[model samples]
Structure formats: C-alpha cells, structure tokens
Target: MSSGDFSLGDFVQRALPLAILGLALIGAPLLIFEPEGLPRMRALSKELAQVKAENVELTRDVAHLRAEVLDLKDNPTAVERIARGKLGLVRKSEVVFQFGKGR
Candidate 1:
C-alpha cells in the first residue's frame, strides 16, 4: 500500500455522503411542491373528516325516523294526530261552523 494511492474503501467513504446529500437536495422540493405530495394528503384528510361527520349525522336522522315510524305504526292516536294536523280531518259526528269574512 502506497501513501499516494487511494484505496477503494477510501473512495467509497468519500463518495457515499455526497451521493446521499445530493439526492436529499433534489428530492425535498419534489415532495413539498408536487401535486401528489403533502398538499394532496392534507386535502384528502380534510375530506375524510367531513364525510365521517356527515355519516354520523345521517345515522342519527335514520334512528329518529325509525322510532317515529314505529310509533305511528303501533299507536292509533299518533296516526289520528298526524291525519288531523296534516290533512285537516275531523270525526264524522263533529259539527262545523262557518263565518263570513269581515272587511
């Protein structure tokens, strides 16, 4: 081994750090600035959170509607209440009164 001659081991130790550093310098900007990078990931995360919240709200609405349907199906008074309030219905024996509009 001569002092003036460079060995393969010495060459690798010198070149490896420069190679890794060069790759990092080139790759960091691509990760930050590319369309499919950090920005896309953040956008998708926000969309997922919104969708999950909507799903929770819809689930609650479905539960409430199911209970109302069950009540209407089993309770006659509930049915009559809805019919009277929404359809302007009355019993057959009920009397009616009419008044003229006053100016």
Candidate 2:
C-alpha cells in the first residue's frame, strides 16, 4: 500500500483512538459534574445513611414505647405512679400537704 493510499482499515485504526480519546474527554467531565453522576450518588448515599440512622432511632423509640405500653398494661404500680405523679390523685382518706418554694 502506498503512503497516500489510505484505506478504510487505515482510517479506522487512526480515527478510532482519536474518537475514543475525544469521547473520554467529553464523558469524564460529564460523569464527574453531571447532576445524576458521582456527586449525586454520594449525596444519595449520605442521605441513605442518615435515613438508616433515623430508622434505627425510630425503631428503638418504638420498642421503648411498646415496652412502656406493656408495662403500663401489666403493672398496676406503674399506673398508680403515673396517676399520682401526673394527676396528683390520692386515694380515700389520704392526707395531702403543700409547701411553697423555699429561699
């Protein structure tokens, strides 16, 4: 083949690398900077971690509430304590006292 006689194979071999390089240059920045790319993925991962932590905390709170509900259901003393503490309730013939704040 003569030097000037460029065939399809020659064009393909020469242009393929340039095409690949051009695509890389254009795509690399898009991958890094695009809204749906690495940055968004990282943000989503952080949000997922935060959501998972919140879920765990909520799960703990739910368990605590369930246990408290069970305790209030099964334990008569718990009910009495809440009633007396929150409601200032007293039984019949119970004496009551009041005091002002002291200096």
Predicted model with the maximum TM-score: 2
TM values, all candidates: 0.64, 0.67
What are the clash counts of all predictions, listed in order? 0, 0
What residue pairs clash in candidate 1, if any at all?
Answer: none
lDDT per residue as tens, model 2, 1-103: 7799879998999999999999999999988898989889899999999999999999999999999999999999999999999999998899988999999
Q: List the residue pairs that clash in candidate 2.
A: none
Determine which window of 10 residues in candidate 1 has minimal summed lDDT: 89-98
Off by over 4 Å in 2: 1-25
Task: State the lDDT at 15 in candidate 1.
Answer: 100
Q: Which whole-number lDDT from 0 to 100 does residue 95 have in model 1?
A: 83
What lDDT score goes with residue 83 in model 1?
90
